[model samples]
Target: MKKVLFGLLLAGLMSTTQAAVAQSGSGPAVSYTETVLAAEIGKEILFRRALDWTENHFSYGPKTGAKSDAAAGTVRVTGTGKVTPVATNGKELTRVIRFDFVFRATDKGYDYSVGSFRVIPDPQKPEETMMLSDYIAQLATEKGNGKTFNDRRVTAQANALASEAAMSFRSFMNTMPAAEENTVGIPATE
Candidate 1:
């Protein structure tokens, strides 16, 4: 009877841990979509600007940059970047994150989405980025009461990076010359 009781208690604890972990929600992939201003101008300029932005902000090799399917009116880009964790007088750690960006162009405007982000600890080993809930769970375990990690701050920084990327494309569009009639490709299939 004592053995049975002990087994039951252990099972209960395991279930509680599973429940707590499950409650932490999905990961740190933040999806963002925006309508770009120069859709009618052709996707070429958009692709170019996106490539430039990726090169400047994210680490990309000579062969990397925007991948576009003109017939499908879609462009995708994937890259990784290193961000320094804010100062806490801590270890001065830098985190590397990878992201996927997709852009779909239309006649009047273009839609872009950014997501599929993860933290890459080593060139060979990549880990899922922690969501705000996951950080909160860590805080609880550490009894940090917000001292262990600033989840909100990290989230804000991620958002700011995304916003900056969008703004870069927008700025490029604003300064872009209108497309010549002959240069514009056929409208993408419905």
Candidate 2:
């Protein structure tokens, strides 16, 4: 009975440790990339769509610093969003996540890559920032006390942000915009 109980206890401890490592960003940094196929769509039209999508997705009254080069058929956008991770004490910790969106328009479709994730732990101290992957690795190395809970929350939130951005952009790019009416000098029938 004693040996059985000891074995069970050891198993539990090992599982707990494994869970901590998994939650602590033991793998690579979070990023998303996808290639979208738009049949019968010209490069210029796709370029315009990419610009419009960036503006709609990232703009909140202020300029999103989205730039596009028609000649090169590329659009670049820098985006920032907030993620709230609850601490062990149940207090919400707000972190700002910054990422980049690059869209390359081709004759048949477009390719987009979203990456370069950085997290600003404190909004007041913007200069003190670190990569999301680094933060997770640091958390993984810490003593597994109650801190692991918060660490897990942080990793989950950051990953969710990356996934959301990538999936939303993919959905937008897959859609077809309504055709614009060339109503120059046309009288209104209504």
Q: Pick the candidate with the highest lDDT.
A: 2
Q: Per-prediction count of colliding residue pairs?
A: 0, 0
Candidate 1: lDDT over CA atoms? 0.57
Candidate 2 structure, TM-score to reference: 0.74
**Tens-digit lDDT track of model 1 for 128-172:** 464433442343444332463534445555666666656655665
Show model 2 residue runs off by greater than 4 Å.
Answer: 1-25, 59-64, 143-148, 178-190
Best by TM-score: 2
Task: Give TM-scores for every candidate, taking all chains together and pairing residue i with residue i.
Answer: 0.57, 0.74
- The residue pairs that clash in candidate 2, if any, are none
Writing each residue's lDDT as its tens digit, candidate 2 over 2-27 gives: 99999999999999999996665546
Evaluate model 1: give its TM-score.
0.57
Worst 10 residues of 1 by lDDT: 55-64
